[model samples]
Each structure stands twice: as C-alpha cells, then as structure tokens.
Target: MKYDVAVIGAGPAGAMASKYAALNGAKTLLIEEHASIGSPVQCTGLISKAALTECEISEGSFVLAKMKGAFVYSPGGEELTIRGKDVKAYVIDRKLFDRELVGRSIDTGADLMLKTRFMGLHHGRISVLSSGERKDIHADIVIGADGIMGSVGRAAGLPRCKKFLSGIQFEAPYDACDAQFVEIFTGNKFAPGFFAWAVPFGRMARIGLAKNAGDRPALHYLEELIKHPVLASRYRGSRTEHVVGGIPLGAPERTVKDNVMLVGDAAGQVKPTSGGGVYMGAVCAKIAGEVAARAARKEMDIKEYEKKWRSAVGRELALGMIIHKSLGKLSDENLNEFISFLNRPGMSECITEYGDMDHPSVLLKEMLKGADKMRLVRLLGVAFKTLF
Candidate 1:
C-alpha cells in the first residue's frame, strides 16, 4: 500500500494525527497493533477539562465521573481540602474514549488498519506484520505515536524519554467522602519518590500509585497504599480490575529526523507531575499531522513539527519536570510541611484559582508570587533551586 502520510499506532495521538493529516489534504492511514482499540486499558483515566477540549469531545458515555475538587493527605495524615468553583476534570472509560477518537479519524478520511504491527522501516517504506503476513507500505512522511516501547522511534533512531514512572492501579468499591472530589495520598511508606491516589466514581474508585522507587516495585507501594486508614476504610478488600503501566516523564532532546517524527508517548509528550499524556500528546500530534502533510507534499521540512510543538508546550513541560523532581526528592517530613503550607489560609484559594491539571507551571508561578521565599527554600531542598 502507498500513502502520502502513514501514522503508526491507533491511540489518541495516532488517531488525531491521521485525522488532522487527512483534514489538511494528505492521504492518511492509521494502523493499530491490537485487534481492537483500547482493549487493555493502562491509564488512570483522570483528565482535565482542557484535555477534553483538546480531544474535541464533550461529555459522553466514556465519562464516568466529574471531579470538582481534591482532598490531599500529608504523610502525617493531615488533610487539605481544595475545592474548585466547578467541575475540573473527568474519570473516563479509556476503551470507549479511544474508540471514539479512532472513529473520528475514520470519519475524517483516514484509513484504518487493525492487527498491524510495525516491524521496522525499509528503504523509506514501513515494514509491518499484518494478520500473520509481512508487508511494506510506502509513505513520504511517518508519524510515530506508537508509544514509549514502540518501534517507530527506534527504527528512526530517535532518542527516548528521559525516564519512566512505574504505575499500578485497581478498581474497587469505595467509600468516598464526596463523589465529586478526588483524594490524593502522599508519603514515603506509601509511595516513595511519587504519590498515591483514589479517584472516585459514584461508589467505586480507581486506586493507584506511581513511583520512581526502583527496589520497591509499584505493587509494593500499592500494598501499603491500600492499608492507609483512608483507603482501608473506603476499600472493600476486593478489586474488579487491575492495571500496570510505565509512564514516560520527559521529552527527548529531539523528535524528528528525515521523513519521520514522533508524538505522544513515543516522543514523551506526557506531563511529568501528573503522568498524563493525552493533553500534551493531542497538542503535539496536531502539529505532527499538519507538518507531515506539508512535508509529504515537499512544501515543508519535518523539522517544523519539532519547532512548532516545542514552542507550544516546551515551557510547561520543562517546568512540570522541575516540580516533579523536587516533589520526588521530598522526605516524609518535607511532604507534611509542604502540604501544611498548601493548607494555609489563602493557599487553597490560590489553588482553586490557578491549579490546572494540564499546566501545573501556571499554578507554580502563581503560588511563588504570594509565597514566602524563605519557606519555599526549606521545603524543596536542592531541586527547588532549579525553579527560580
């Protein structure tokens, strides 16, 4: 098969890229390795209102819950309630969400190929194993939205994401203080180098943790997470579904080479602080699609994709990385103090005004303006030095 632009993977990024490519006049094809899209779900499925806008979808059957606030717990078990003015995020069914995205891509003139595994690149063509048969497809521009462990970036010789956070979660019956509020738990014994969370949906919640702890696997942290007084009280000691995944944290130095470019997890377009990829991935995927379409017509350089995407989100991603690093290094004592500070008068108001799930740097900047500089110094240690 031949095409003007070929996008690998049928996830949100790949689907969006192919859709935009076709929308911009490029003949496009989107391929998925799985027989069905979004079969084995991996995400915690919590996304900001901005993420939904980026995906161009409104509340649908995929939206299982609407979150209006969060209740954060310190290591010492101090509680901090942050209430938003209105709904701030959503808990989604990823299987339905992904299918909707791919369906949109197909509606926009992008061809779909299921059960196609990308093998490698050959002589400017893509080699794939489709339905137990090896074949090659010709395309002028290739967009790699295949994910972190994907082959497209490797075949293109592009560098990988800086690091990965190990994540584990399970769905279970829950006792939620407020169905509209998500709960955040932080401390060393529970989730060293990261944090744990319980995102509620009516009487159920997605309980999970992500960590940089190497010796202690995600499962180790999970075992302790469920034992927390808050979790133990809410959890019914039973789980219906479990998920394990690695979340890439930072973008590589480069994401484009010759006729190829990377997007989504393959290019590490995820938020370091939140480990969410959909928002950033959708932003970059549109750029990749537009640039790839132009490049296919010999009217633009693929490097334009890199330049534009970075310009759009580079500062946000970089600042988020700085915050993630500082937070990861904090000791239990430090976390208690940090959460305490955030719980202070006026702090919750600031959070309600400025907290953005997709753009945390905005809140950080706003907080630094009102915060006592000396107090910040004591909390963050050396990693805090990079922020200012």
Candidate 2:
C-alpha cells in the first residue's frame, strides 16, 4: 500500500501521530503487530490529567480509578502526603486505553492494519510482513512510533536512548489508607536508582518498580518490594498477570533522520522522575505528525520535526534527568533529612499550591522561594547547579 505517512505501531503514541497526520490532510496508515490494538499490557497505567487532555479523549471505559494525591514513603519509613485539591491523575486499563486511542485515529481517516510487522527499510520504502505476507510500501514520510524495540529506528540507524531501567509489575488486591492516594516507596533496599510504586484502583493496585542500571534484575527488586513492611500488609497471597519491561530515559541527541521521525517510547520521551511516557510522548507525537505531513507536501524539511519537538520539551526532559540523578545519589539519611524538611509546618502547603506531575520544575522554583533556610538552600543549590 502507498501512503503519504506510515506510522508503525498502534500504541497511544502511534495512534495520536497517525490521527494528527490524517487530520493535517496526509493519507496516513497505522500498523500494529498485535492482532488486537492493545494486548500484553506493559504499562502501570497511571497518567496525569494533562495527559488525558493531550490524548484528546474524555474519560472512558479505560479509566479504572481517579487519584487525588500520593503518600510518599521516605527511606526512613516516614510518610508524607502530597495532596492535590482536585483530581491529579488516573489509573487506567492500558489494553482498553490503547484500543480507544486507535479507534479515535481511525475515526480521523487514518487507515488501520493489524498483524503487520515492520521488517526493515528498503530503497526509499519500508518492508513489512503483513498477515503472513511480505510487502513493500513507499511513503513520503515514515514515523517510528514503535516501542523500545523499534525496528524503524534500527532501519534508520538512529542512536538508542541513553539508558534503560528494568521494570516489573503485578496487579493485586490492595488495602490502602485512601483509595485516591497512590503510595510511593523510596529506599535503596527497594529500588536503588529509581523508586517503587503502588497505584491504587479501588481495592486493587498495580505494584511495580524499575531498577537503575545494576546487576540485579527488575524481578529481584519486585521480590524484595513485596516484602516491604508496608506492601506485605496489603498484598493478598497471590500473583497473576506479571509484566516485565524496560523504561527508557534521556533521549538520543537526534530523534529524526532523513525522512523518518521517532515518537513515544521509541524516542525515549519518557520522564525519568516518573517513568511515564504517555504525556511527553503525546506532546512530541503531535509535532512529529504535523511535521511529517507538512514534509510530505515538501513544505518543510524533516529536520523541522527535530527542532520543533526539542524546543517544546527539551528543557523539561533535561531538568527531569537532573532531578533523577540527584535523587538517585541520595543516601537513606539524606532522604530522611529531605523528607523531614518537607514535613515542616509550611512546606506541604507550598507543594500543594504549586505541585504538578507534568512540571516538577514549577514546584522546585516555589520551594526555592523559601531558600533562606539552609537545608533548602543546600538542596536547591545542588539541584539548581545541575540545571544551569
């Protein structure tokens, strides 16, 4: 089949990219390797409200729970509650969510092809094995919305994301203090570089962790996480539907090469602090699609895709990397001190007023307003130095 744009992958990123491309008047085709749109769910499904807006979909069957806040557990086991006055995020069923996104894309005039596996690129075209039959398609612009194992990226010889974290998770019946408050576990014992999370959905929660670059695997961390004093109390005596995956961080210097552009996990647009990609991926994918469509018309260079997307989110991603590195370097004692500082009389209120999942730097600036306090000064000095 021939098209102006071919988006390889039917995940949220690819769906949005194809939808935007079609909306911009490009004849777009979205291909999914899986028989179904969403299957073998790999995500924990905690998405910010802004993320939902970016995806342009209202609450649907995919939304399992809405969360208002998070209960953060410091290394010393001291709990601090970061509350939002309104709904902060949602816990979703990724399988249903992916289907919804693809449906919307199809509605926008993007053709859909299932059971299509992208093989590689040929001379100015793409090779795919569709439904057990091999074929070649010529396209003005190709988008690699595929996941971490993106064949399009390989075909284009794009560099990989800087690093990857091993992740493992399982759904289980949970006993939580508040249904709206997700639980965060932070300590070297549980996750050395990153943190563990229990995102609640009614009486059930998705418990998972992503391990930093280390010898230990993600499952090893999951094994240790379940035994945590907090998780051990809530987890029912059962295990089912476990997911193993990799979380990518720090995008490669280039996400666009020649006539191809990368979006979502394929581009490593995930936030290091949260290990979430849907929000940032959607933000970048729109630009990728628009650029791809415009480039197909010979109205813009494909490199415009690179420049525009980076100008939009490059700073935030860079800041997130700094925060991730700072937190990963902290000792148990340092974490205790940091949490203790936040537990002070006036601190939580400040966080509540300015905190945002999609923009932590906003909260950081607010926190720095009270930098007269030496502890806050020391911490901000270290983190702010990285940003500059």
Candidate 3:
C-alpha cells in the first residue's frame, strides 16, 4: 500500500480528487464502495448557484431551495416559465452534499477507504476487496471517481459505455410543491431521452426521470411520469422515496488514458441539456485536483493529465454532447415548438445565463442566438436524422 494519489471514488469526483491531492503535498487516497458516503441516493440534487460558487460549496451546506425560476412542461400541456435573477437553483442535501464532500476530503489530508472494492488494475497497481482482505494498492496517480457503472472506468480502459439515461428519483410528502419553482416535464409521453423533474426539497420534493434505455425502463419512465395529466393533478396524495439510477447520455470516449484520471459520473461529466452532474462533477474534480497535483510533482506527461482535463471540462462536455444530440430528436410537436420558443421575452434570461454549468458551450452558443432560427435549423435537421 503506497500512494501519491489513488482516489478511486468517493463521489464528488473522488472527493475533489482526494482533496486536491492532499492539498498538493500528495500521498492522497480516498476509495469507497459505499459503506456510506452519499449512499444509494442517485442524483436529482439540482445545483447552480453558479455551481455552488465553483465548488467552494457552502450556502450553509445546502437544502436551501430558492430557485426563482424554471418550468417547461409541454406534451400539449404547454407551459414555460424560466425566470431568475436572485436565486437560480439549489435543492441539495445529497446526503448533506456527499457528507460535505467527504468531510472536505477527510479535512484535506485524504486517506479514506470505506468498504473498499476497487478490485483490479494490475501494473499501475490498485486491486482491493477490503473488509475480508485481498489488498494491494500503489499509485503515482489514479482517479476514476467511480460512477456510471464505473469500475474505475472499466479498469482504466476508459469507455465505460455511454448513451445511457435510465433515472428515477423519489422523495415525497408533498402538497403541490413549488418551493420557488423547478419543474420540467417535456414530451415523449413524459420522458424520452431526458426531462422530468420536480425538485423542491424544503419540505421533500424530488420526483424524477431520465428514461431512454432505447426508450423505457427508468422504472417504467418513472411510472409514466407519475401518471401524467399535469403530474397526476399535482401530488394526488404524495409519499415517495424510491430513487433508482443510471444517467450518462454522452461524452466519455476518453476522459484520460495512461496513469488514469476521470472525474464525476466516471467522466461522462453529465449535463447534456440537463441531467446535471453535481456542477460538472465538482468542476471536473477541481480540474482533476490541479492536474493530479501537477502529475505528481513534475513527473508529468500523463498526456498532461488529458490536456488539463480537456482545458477544464472539455468545452462544456463537448457542448453537452451537442445538446444531448439535439434533444434526442425532439418531436412532441418538436417539444411544443421548443416550449413556445422558450417563452419569448429574453428567452428565460438566456436560459438562466446559459445554464452556467461552467460555460456550457458558452450558454449553448447563447441559447442558439435566442432560438427560433428557422426552428433551430429544423432542430438541426432533426438532430442529423436522429443521430445518423
């Protein structure tokens, strides 16, 4: 057992890359196969207070739902809200935000290892199994923020499958929630590639969905989006807590190779339109913990840690993988004419200042120039004929 860095996954991009590689002195470590770090609570913890002030994280450790805007239903139910100026988003409490990011990476000294379980990665070391023994851990650097079916990104071969979606959150005890707005239903009978949320959180509220397992099975599209019809007539006797998961969508051909490196959702950095990835996996795990502590003190050349985490979050996850392949070929009457052209008038404050998930394609090319450019070029020619 040796390490300069071996942050398999304690979420929040392996706890901010083992707390910035043990605050840059290295010798970090932060494994976890969940003996509880943010337990079985797969996402829906909406974010955006400029991504919790770029991971400095502390609005009194969240649970403060003050979103002043967002509502975009329409499967013929048409509706659109978008407002925002004061508070834009926040419904966290993801187990107290993953235990305050693994207690600030064990108070910045790193070294965790709950319930272990990494189990393989020969040459570069790392092969655990914990509790019942079978260890061996070495590293000059390794971080795969295990997630999205991540086994440290398939033991570092990268490509841990993509084009996923299948979500299904829950947390109810409602009575027509609107803790300041955050509903977003969308077409395809509720959820196709993505879209379906409630997210209140002050008095319980998280109802979710993400579908697209080639079209169904995200708990049967979250039980047909809570039996639609305006979300089953608002609450209709709430009481949930379920929460299933699986949400990737696109972008993860390679989040880095050789000496490893792959942050949040194991580098799918999720968001394509809005699947959210805890502020782009904690700002790409704080730029892969300052480029893995300068690739462990100038020993550099891990492809310059994937070109410095693709220059900090590869162009907003490659423009959210091209707006999640053009909103998965719209249709629901083209998402009710793109929600009536994003409810006109300054298009929802330029979609809340370009959904600033850290420069999401520069706010998606400025919300495609206030949209409606010939119906966004006929929805990018139906997203290039449905993703070719």
- lDDT for each residue of candidate 3 in 131-233, tens digit (9 for 90 to 100): 8698999887788888887887787787764677777777885545467888888777668756788777566677887766344566776777888776676
Candidate 2 displacement at residue 253 in angstroms:
0.7
**For model 1, where is the 10-residue window of minimal lDDT?**
379-388
Give the Cα lDDT of each candidate.
Answer: 0.90, 0.89, 0.75
Q: How many residue pairs clash per model?
A: 0, 0, 0
Pairwise TM-score winner, candidates 1 and 2: 1
What TM-score do all the candidates reach, one by one?
A: 0.97, 0.97, 0.35
What C-alpha lDDT does candidate 1 achieve relative to the native structure? 0.90
Alpha carbon lDDT of residue 282, candidate 3?
79
Mind giving the per-residue lDDT tens digits that candidate 2 earns over 9-111? Answer: 9989999999999999999999899999888789999999999999999999999999999999998899999999999999999999999998999999999
Across 1-388, the per-residue lDDT of candidate 1 in tens digits comes to: 8999999999989988998999899999998999999978998899999989998889999999999999999999999998999999999999999999999999999999999999998878999999999999998899999987968999989888999988999999999989999999999888778889999997999999998764877898899999899989889998999999999989989999888999999999999888899999999998899999999998998899988999999989998888898888877877888999888888889999998888887887787788565676666654465335
Ranking by lDDT: 1, 2, 3
| Strongest candidate by TM-score | 1
- Model 1 misplaced regions, further than 4 Å: 381-388
lDDT of 3 at 247: 77
lDDT: worst 10-residue window of model 2: 379-388
**Residue 360 lDDT in candidate 2:** 89
Candidate 2 achieves a global lDDT of: 0.89
